[model samples]
Target: MKKIIMAILLLPIFLNFSGCTKKTNEIPKTSTKIEKSAIEDKKSKVNIILFYPSKEGSSLSASSRLVSFNNSLERTILEEFLKGTDTKDTLYIIPKGTKLLSVSRKEDTIILDLSKEFNDISTENEAVLNNTIYSIVNSLTEIPGIKNVIIRVEGKVPKINNISFENPFKRNRSIFNRDKTSKPNDILKKQMEFESQGRWLDAYLLYSDDENNTYRKYFDDYVKENEEAFAQGFISKNFTVGSYTVDNTGTHALVKVKFNDTNRELNIGMIKIEESWMVDWIPPQ
Candidate 1:
């Protein structure tokens, strides 16, 4: 009878130990569903994004084709301004001439590294250059969050045909789309019709002042000076240019651009300056 009593007491202790062990071992399971949920939560926070802007001028068609969304127009504007060419027919190959070498995105700008063949492929013909310009800008500008595009070739900076590539324009870059506030300078604007058509060398001379803009003295002398009138007339914030062709002599162009606030359109023309690349627009302050 005493042995039976001892056995009953040991049984209660064993049951208590077993219950404690089961409680200590239990844990919540984290499976694929939980992990996926965490990842999705992280992705939801990254909605705002900026795109690349162009230093090379491209064509309107090129800009339009850069992206599908409407907000991407900023990116296209920068690109077309820099590239100064149209790239519509190159659908047989890649959309933008040679394939892009590399594309890096910064806060408000995009740095694009071009393939080696960029210089050799389109170097000879002005039409090719225009096509190239239009294609690159039109394509990239359609993406939102991109404001600037700095183009390089084979990991090196390519020189502008006539002018320096060093300057980036805030005035030009700041405004996009057609501005309702803009007007026209009927006489000067009409004189500059060809500049928008991609006459690069002629466009450059129209703006370039000899040695520190000594040419500005002639701004007072409006009759003989075509470029000064064009510069003086630029008063609006917005700008837009349509598609066109270029005649290539590998020479830099003198550009006379008149912004007609009354007409709300830019009048562009070109005269031969020298052999060099023509940058489309300088940023306004």
Candidate 2:
């Protein structure tokens, strides 16, 4: 009878050990699922458009920035646009004390009611007036369902200089920056544009073969090793193209860039390869 009781007590211990062993083997599978979920979450991102004054202060340019997916995407985009660019390379055209009163959607249009402070912008500078209007308009129109933007100040349609706010404002791509007969300058502009938006691969592809340039030979490896620094370096440096000189052959060019972060200027070298102008070397940070 004692042996029978002993067997009954040991049975529970044996079953418990087996169950623990099974779970131990399953742990790796559970961890893998969690890792995959994290990767999927990272892959899911949304793009938001932001308008900022050009580095050369010519006009406003639109930059695409990524953010985590959210239900209130419009509201989130508006908030981020209002906050302005972190790098300060571009000017925040919005007036101070401005608030987003309300956002209403109708069909394919979005109506934004802004606070009275928005009307306080000076109309003397027509460029400023135009930029201010479309900065808000252009930024909001980037949202999927918003084809047009209607703006109101304190619930009343206000006039910004000569332009009327009564009608819905469509996107004005012409107002954005454009190339002006300087193809090499345009290439440099694109390089900075991609870098600003954290599109490293797009930016890296602009480089050309230079045996002396480490960035060309080990470009991918260098970016992988210094991913964080590479991103920070590009985003933080607001480069203003100062002066550009092209060789008589049109194959070699030296472009000077002024940085907001440093007093020193950066001289970037470019070479025309075949029919395209490519960056010869990565600019020193």
Candidate 3:
């Protein structure tokens, strides 16, 4: 009778110890599952488009990148914009040492408060100032549901030259290096045709508004100089159009053209302007 009672007591103790051991092992597994779920959330990503100035500072170039998605997505984008791009032949238009102070959204507009360095760009030159503002505006407006951007320096709107930041700035499509509607080859062919027909004004219109081009700056002088070439048929019969290759940025291209009745190939530089490609530089015949 004494042996049977001891055996029953020991059986209960063994069962209780086994139950405690199982609960301890299960605790770590449950914790591991929760940790895995949190890690998955952190790994989530979303695609975003960023705009930067072209190396020439004549137009804006669009770059697409994947960024982590979270509650502070807008802020994250602005931070990325400030960090600039690694793309060659592109420029980070934002003033160096500039910092994003804060960001908030109201309806369709996002207000960006930036450090004082943001206002230190060259305001005297209209193109430079316009490019600087649009680089930020165009970048943020790429976000869905965000139609405009309001820029502020030190919590207050700034007036730089003719541009006033008191109101929300909308995205300007004219500032982009290229749009979806045009091809570089087609544009170059059209320009050459216009030149062959002696349509000087038409050819001039095809040229980009590059601040550095003397022909664009002195339109009358360009036409006067080209008159003799047009009369001699030199401009019309110089080269035959050939194959072309565009760069990865899509803003620049190398077009090949052959000298008339010769095996000589001349490579011309083409730059995208708005929706059309414009001859950046044409070599002397």
RMSD of each: 27.1, 18.6, 25.8
TM-score of each: 0.29, 0.48, 0.49
lDDT by residue for model 3 (121-175), tens: 6634467667867988877765545677889999987867788887888877787
TM-score of 2: 0.48
Off by over 4 Å in 2: 1-45, 55-57, 68-70, 179-285
Estimate the TM-score for candidate 3: 0.49
Work out how many backbone clashes candidate 1 has.
72
Question: How much is the lDDT of residue 10 in candidate 1?
Answer: 42
Residue-level error in angstroms, candidate 1, position 264: 33
Q: In model 1, what is the error at residue 26, expressed in angstroms?
A: 32
Cα lDDT computed for each candidate against the true fold: 0.35, 0.63, 0.66
lDDT by residue (tens digit), candidate 2, 152-223: 888999876678877889866556544334577678777766766656545655655333344443333323
Please rank every candidate by lDDT, starting with the best: 3, 2, 1
Worst 10 residues of 3 by lDDT: 1-10
